[model samples]
Target: MATLDHILRPLPLLFIIFVISSLHVLPASATSSDKLKTATTIRKVNRKGPYVGLVTVIETEEDAFLASVEFRPDPNHPFIDLSGRRFRIGKIHGKKVMYVRCGRGMVNAAAATQQMIDVFDVKGIVHFGIAGNINNSMSIGDVSIPNQITNAGLWDWLNPDKAEGSDNEAYLDIGNYNVPQSDGNNNMLGSLRYGHEQLYSVNGHISSPQNVFWINTTQEWLHLAADLEKMELLQCVNASLCLPEKPKLVVGLKAATANIFVDNAVYRDFLYDTFEVSSSDMESSAVAMTCVSNGYPVIVIRGLSDLAGAQTGTNAIRKFGSLAAANTARAVLEFIKKLPSNYNVNS
Candidate 1:
């Protein structure tokens, strides 16, 4: 037999050389295959369009149903399903429209809106659904067209004693504090970024620099809402469920968006008094922000389904959610019909 070192040294060197060659060959080949597969998948699923987008929150399936009913889907051009999210192309009022149901809450709304813009070439967005009424003057089934939407929970929570100013304006003082940033997730607070900016103005007046992230609807869209406001809204969902008051469209009001489902009278009062918002919802402001970022116009039409915490008994959402959704759908369809055939979102 050969001496141990002499026999094993050449074999070990050869083994190392073989392993290095395999690593280079295998990984390079695998990476190339992966790239090819990715390219093929993108080619298969990518959609091209000059389409208008409509978004509805999942909590209000009635809204999505009503919107889908207005559109006549083309069998030859079926909706492209990306993963589980479906994007349907259809004709509404003779206009090419894409309908998607964005799940409830701020993050879901933002992600869905951006997807429509990036993947579907969505020119503009119209979001419809139900909201909780903060204004006592409004009733169930009434529609609110918000000119401005602010994130309600984007704030620095401070002790009442630490806050400066009168009790009515005490929240403004907390704006000075550099609180850890959060993405509305309780556990992930302070992980992503830091500090807050003055992103909201109460009725166009900026009182505090923290606690609000406001996004204004485009003027063109608001003008369209003004015209739609003139149209009569549906007052009943069915024979068994008629609104106590005739549903009316109220435009130019403010709305608040948050992840919380607010059913407390005290919080409702705080939001209404602080923001002068007529309605509160879980999605609209985030949708507004996405549209704004894309340089696209967006309008939010919310039908009141509850009094938000004013009632002591069962929530009105159970009773009037369908009616509110129908009214919102009606308003959105009417708005689409009124759009000029040559309306260019770019202009």
Candidate 2:
């Protein structure tokens, strides 16, 4: 003899209990005396800002060709469209994503990266693509994520005269030398923050440092040795100052390092045996440094495409480049999806 409202009120709770009981639900016995709640609650999803930008630099049609193959149109994202220049710019995976075709070299890469941050108002940026392997232990398909960066050519000694002189040579020195915002002695205090890490270093090579290396095992390569090599590192780092709130940045995922060019491998054995590098390519160091200086989380993923040693006649670069680029792209997309809501300064 309960009222209809009272009967329905209990019905919902009763049904829930019935369903749980029928399903043989029971909490795991973690300890001897722990009590279990009647129902397990689902945690709410804390969605963050969608990753808004991804940048890649290609020197040739072939380089861009690799990117095009991996970038498929998202069915749910009908608004996504490539600009006339072939850069993908639109909603991707429900985020207002923009892909800019940053041209090759340090300068081009810098310009493109700056525009994406400035015009698009992107909250985050991922600069991806290929790199040449510089470590002998690394194979053609192995990837490199360099946490350090060194501008091999940027460490020569500064003449004291130039600092105090008044000639055009003095002015030229002043114009060219950007005394990195570092404590003169590699002090960690003035270092830039990236994630939980601190990044501090300047460009230029007045003298060769001990560990740096180029294609050849020489003092010069060692002096200018950098974590990665792209044309845009300094420019991108400098540009961050202009943003209202600088975007979080990272570099590289699918790349290889080669002591020699992909087209030639005459000294493959020597390169594999002596030269510390394994694969070969064009960009990455520039991008890596930019991310580090600007306080962004970075992950470098890459795929190996060739063996620089005796097994040299393989067209693995083409076959493996595509696979690596695709795999790298997928990984990057997954990372973007799970970004925490409070990832940047603004958040």
How many clashes in each structure? 1, 51
The C-alpha RMSD of each candidate to the native structure, in angstroms, is 13.8, 21.5
Whole-model Cα lDDT of every candidate shown, in order: 0.70, 0.38
lDDT string for model 1 (144-181, tens) is 99889887756554444342333222253322223473
Error of 1 at 174 (Å): 14
Off-target runs (Cα >4 Å) in candidate 2 are 1-51, 59-87, 91-96, 150-280, 291-299, 308-310, 342-347
How close is every model to the real structure, measured as TM-score?
0.73, 0.43
List where candidate 1 sits over 4 angstroms from the true fold: 1-48, 62-64, 67-69, 159-212, 343-347
* Clashing residue pairs found in predicted model 1: 155-211
Candidate 2 lDDT over residue span 227-317, tens digit each = 2222121111133322122111223222323222544344444333332334444444444444433334334333344453335466555
RMSD of 2: 21.5
